[model samples]
Target: MSDTSSRIAIVTGASGGIGKAVAERLAADGLSVLVHYSGNAATAAETVAAITAAGGKATAFGGDVADEDAMGRLFQHAIDTFGGVDVVVNSAGIMPLAPVVDTDLDTFDRIQRTNVRGTFVVSQLAARTVRPGGAIINFSTSIMKLQMPTYGAYAMSKGAVEGLTLILAREMRGKDITVNAVAPGPTATPLFFEGKPQEVIDHIAGLNPMQRLGTPQDIAEVTAFLAGPGRWVNGQVLYTNGGAA
Candidate 1:
């Protein structure tokens, strides 16, 4: 339809994985999307192309999610191009598996910068800029609930995102904005497959009642609901892993 009448979404880290799925799903739902990528413009282009080829509106923008200035521009670009933003999905994150004692200080710092500070930067901007009736969705992980080893450092960062999601929802009481986080369980993404043997994957998949790994579309369905009809799902984290929690 028309640009002025359509909802607009900015899906950070939309180059692939859950981020790409969210962008495509939102676009399919009639929202014009700005596909944001950190260092993967080509893949981000694929996301945009897929949306457009399906008769949905989309374009890619590259920027560091952790940089406040860059993220501010991203918000502005959405406003400038699509009239205003109705949804913001902070799905960009880095997961480096390590036990706390074995975690390198540098890697830990990098995780904090991209996962924690990055979510904060984009979130505050969404708070100020996303139009009323909009939604802010941040990505956390099931690791927080899994209590699994080698995810300690990553879990710590997501804990902060959870705190931010809940507090922001309350802070937006009169603003009519919903702030929620989607903590997905084990999913089949390229990142998830790295270095894992088939047996290990099968074991993890079997932990859930569904006895399968979640697909990116599984997470996207929950996100699409929150961004649209699920307005009451605010200030909460939806564990969307086929009962994998």
Candidate 2:
């Protein structure tokens, strides 16, 4: 657990559950993962060949996180392939259940354009390209504190990502970035039993109270401890859910 942050991570839906376990735990704590993916480019090249066959330092990218020119060419292909972009991680989303009177305004605007405007266009490009001590995280759902019931349009798009991670941690305070928002609960992804049944996925994995169901490395170890403890845990949303709420 030592390779300390030199920084360079992108991670949006990195081709699997919880963005491939937060891009292999942020490249096993070293951080040089760009992974990202939209239409599974061969499972994002098998999550960059299993993070370069485990010697960590990944790459595989793609786009369409609600496309703003494919998120500015996915942050210009992670700043021309790993040279900038500190840590973004908005685990690309979609959870369609309906039930707000059978909601459908084009499925609530395509789940608020991919979970609230793809985490506000990747936190407005990590608030203008993160670098100075960067970190953004943002993916949310413990069914918004378990207010479950066909998951109100995926908890109203993760309640606008917990109010946009508290207004982007007060709009990146002094730019010493740290935006935070990890809400995971019922896990066991395949997009959380994507078409349910199998006794409704064994009753949603026994309604999680540690009765099981949550492990994309359990929300990638609380998003690798909020992108490596640049602590103060700004803005905060952290539900990680074994308690199930």
Q: Per-residue lDDT of 47-152 in model 1, one digit per residue for the tens? A: 9999999999988889998899999888888988888999999999998887799999999999999999999999999999988889999999898888998889
lDDT of each: 0.92, 0.84
* TM-score winner: 1
Q: Give the TM-score of candidate 1.
A: 0.97
- Clashing residue pairs found in predicted model 2: none
Error of 2 at 231 (Å): 20
lDDT of 2 at 173: 86
Candidate 2 has a TM-score of 0.34
* Candidate 1 local lDDT, residue 22: 95
